[model samples]
Target: MRGYLAAVAGSEPLTPVSRDWARQRTDLEDEVPVVHEETVTGRRYEGDGIRELRIPRFKSVAGRSGDLTQGEWAETALAAAVLADARPVLSPRWKSQQRLTLGRFTPVTHIRVVEIGCVDASRNVLFEGTPEEAHHRYVRMAEARVRAVKAGGDYLPGQGCGACELVDICPAVPSRPGFLGVDSPPARRRSWSMTTARDYRTCPARAHLKDLFLPRAEAAENTPAIVRGQAVHTAIEELHSRSPVRACASTDAPATPEHWRAGRWEVTGFQARLGTQMVGDHALVCPLHELPGDAQVYPERSLVVHDPDADVVVVAKTDLLYRRTDTWFLRETKTVRSLDESDPLLAYPQLALALLLAHEGAVPGTTEEGTTGCRVELERLTGSGPVLTELDGDDGELLAQARRIVTEHATHWHADEEYVARPGKHCETCPVIQWCPSRPEKSAA
Candidate 1:
């Protein structure tokens, strides 16, 4: 009985269109119509009786690589009339094709964004309006790159892993030996971090050499100031899960022998400045400490999101994340020499990305998500006290600015000829100072 019903369902009449209807998409293939081998196209749907759409078993309605690229959108637009979040049912083309391949289904969490075509209105007429073109500029850039490549410029080292053989000699690549067996030189994909982004803005050559090519400096983490900063950051992080007072009694302690060995400050001095001294209208810690008992904390949460405008992936590891009531928050902690109203860290890119993610509900945080927005906190644990700056919880302006900056940087990231070393204030602290060919000494020569 089951086999008989399955056969009737498989042969049931429904609208069929050429396989190319789902295969070739103009979005990916430079707007060219693609013809496919499968012939079943052009079926008409009539009075609905148990309406269902049949698709290949292995693929998704969202589409994937190769011929199916963007094909899911076709299924999406076609099925938009009535069905939504429709799970495609998999079945063999013929009864004898395979008895084992009877029925399988895959589910999606949410389509994220789906554009359903008009079913009630005229279908034959072309409707020209489009989705919110927030990233249209980046789309144009992608198109331009395609044009550039076809004109004999086949490749360029993007802000990502440049697969070209010339990466070894490329100035955009670092020239230093890595630490141990680990090489952290940035590649074309998953390459742009907050640090690398700053490096690129400050000095492209330094970015190429230190961030891309050279080995990370040995014991860089052991620097006195760095260690102290790490201690403060650790204290702040663990404070979310455990009280600073209770944590000191066990291995959960924030200030450790590591502080004594850090040699940056007398342990007493460090504690006085960090623990006893800092003051503010309401320090970052105050809000953190006041957070409700049930509020969850995510420490050093690493985030990666694609900046479509720049056509690059932007990566960030936030110092801390927390939620209160229903609102989510992201914070960046800094043990700085001083804090001012105009502190550069106030407008930092990492915070911007975090803000954007929180707003988009890209990762878990707020129960309210976009409606409540994410609060961004920048705090400096100074000798004077902790100085804090808060962004409007709902302000998305900073996020937009961050995307623009990254996009602008990415537009020029592929320029191999522009890696000419230049001395700037940034050189004083650059890790790869020895590798720079444009240093004052090298320039004087």
Candidate 2:
């Protein structure tokens, strides 16, 4: 009766679809894109839907060689062939490889500026000249280096592993044999990945070696987290620039002559002040100063300081500065995997330094008054929401601890010992292990 009714209507009866129907819809179809037949080797299948393939010589060098390069090639070729037939080819493995390749080749530059101690930014010159002059000197030095490399002049070997990327590839220098290794010299080594270098301020020795000493061709091969972090930071800055600023109502009269610095300008209903700090009576100093009205302040990102005494400079391009009545706040954006309250590495000392610097640079000799506490609002890029915490006396102590740590590490680093590898969980992901002494055998063996 059902068959007769279906034939009359020219359609199947209305009935529930079995699980198999759904399963078949979801299941990937078997589609072979490429088939390779070798004389000695067996048949090989490659393409989108092909699940299995038989290839000889795969087992012979599987352990020795990191990856089955030949199998991969064959699979890729087969996938292309299958794709050409207008059928979707499954290339999950190839897609992953392409992603890795893209990540590796991506160019990222990490920049960190740390103001060491209280170097008068306005008066104290970096290289005994103007900023432009110093920049020119840097460019000239770079040019001279290029000319030297082109001219095939005498190339001086850098001290320790500060120069060689393939240091582990080659034999360790006899004099500095114990420098990086645990059994060797007692050098204080800090191992950070290229990613870390781009994201944060790493050890100067490591940074110089990888960034300045290593050839551009070699350095570009490895993508450091520091570089990625910096790129993110830059993007945040640009976003902040485009964001609209909400201005507060003006209550008090315009700042008096005594309150205003020389050549100051009041534009957009905000007062901008410029001033310089002087070391002595004879020296005329002018520091680059930018001060917006208290209403115009926005705090977006908190700066981290690694060292205070080692002349390390740390600066942050703030995104949002919040002000409520007389209180001032800073907001800093970060792209971290996770944040822990106990992570002293991200403490408020760096933020304190920024506040202190901003205060001193603007009002000169107002560090004590500026200690009215600050807020570190951590906004995770890939998270549910932002975390806000008030930085207080305890936070100040943490900053002091960070300062001490920096001082101690700097002292150890400058001493006449080889660079010791500070081995820990960080070493597992360290890229410079090829040049690290601690992993000499593990890396080479």
Candidate 3:
């Protein structure tokens, strides 16, 4: 991001010797140097003055790579247009103060902006031109998107809520004085999800590193079981996403199990066969089978709410949310090698969030009786077959159990200021262990 900003803002050009020295340093010993590279082309007409460059960096993950969202495009184009029109020059005195290092102030010049994949070495331009051009493009192609964004009124209290200044008065986030069951006062605002809770339980440093968005070991995250699970989910989601939705069929399972692929996820051999069977099993119990054509179906929709009392933003991602009659259903699907007969909520503590949300009326729909009308279902596609179990979300006993599960998971996490590493055997599978200062090293033995 800094490199892109510097390229746009016209930083001091690197001297040839400095560049070579940096390149040499990067290529230490036998390691290949990943030298930063980019190209900016187009003639700078005389008297064009200074240029303000804007680049909207896009995420570089598999499915998200090489694509700039409509919202992002609209924002960048509108910003460039506004900057080109205003062209306000900051005072030199302000720039001179090192305490406030915004940047060196420069006089106005023609503005140019471009959008690119954040990690694309080719830097293939998505949109690039003068600020006036950007404005025209926005007006012609992107104005409606910008307008729609402005018109959006719903507050989605998520991880970002921790950073939101208006959270104190935000009506969406409920203030439950003892929500997380933590007696210790919050050290600072933070976000807590089941994933965070689980990671913290495994190793505090792993959770903290993930919070900081540190680079992770791809191998650790892409284990065969994980990849198979993702592939199964992608396959199931595609079926649910079809227009004029219909019940999933056995034939919908992967035709070529040897090399089955869905979106950016791929699987083969035993994992592929297992995923195929899971998809087939899901076909037998698809929620849409009994629903009317117009039934609302939301797959992998995120449910975010804030607990101001705990100073935490709670986030849960439901596998499937569907409405039938007056009742809403939150279904959590798990692809497992075998079925377990243990208590589902206790076995999968992640379900506690869904259980609580359903009971608290956080989900959209409700029963005709004017009560929270969410039926929490667990769909386990196991090696044997598909199993569907419904938990009575409105039951007081069940709700209490769910609360205990969440509180147990969240209490220690919410109170900790120093997320110190508790290294152990779990470190072998920690994704961000590469960045852990106290990571265990293999013994020479």
Top candidate when judged by TM-score against the true structure = 3
Badly placed stretches (over 4 Å) of model 1 are: 1-190, 218-227, 241-284, 290-294, 343-347, 366-371, 396-418, 423-429, 433-445
Q: For candidate 1, lDDT tens digit of each residue in 1-445? A: 2322232253435444222111111232456753321112222222233323332221122322234334343333433321222222244443322322212222322111221122111112111112222124224333444344435642323434422334444443332221011222333433556576566767778767865455444353255556556555555455444633221222333333423322233344555345323322123355555555455676677654443323234456787766666666787776666665563334565665555555554444353434364677877667666666786645456655644554444445443435666677766666777567787774554
Report the candidate with higher TM-score, 1 versus 3: 3
Q: After superposition, how far is residue 387 of candidate 1 from its true place, in Å?
A: 3.4
| Clash counts for all predictions | 16, 39, 0
Which regions of candidate 3 fall more than 4 Å away from where they truly are? 1-10, 13-73, 85-107, 110-144, 153-177, 214-219, 367-372, 424-429, 434-445
Which scores higher on lDDT, 1 or 3? 3
What is the TM-score of candidate 3?
0.73
Q: Is candidate 1 or candidate 2 better by TM-score?
A: 1
**Alpha-carbon error at 329 in model 3, in Å?**
1.7
What is the number of residue pairs that collide in model 2?
A: 39
Off by over 4 Å in 2: 1-205, 210-232, 243-328, 338-341, 344-377, 393-396, 414-445
TM-scores for candidates 1 onward, in order: 0.45, 0.31, 0.73
Score candidate 1 by TM-score against the native.
Answer: 0.45
Worst 10 residues of 2 by lDDT: 273-282
User: Which of the two, 1 or 2, has more lDDT?
Assistant: 1
Residues 224-343 of candidate 2 have per-residue lDDT tens digits of 433334434443343334334322112111243123222122222111111100001001110101233323443343222212122222233354555444344555444443455565
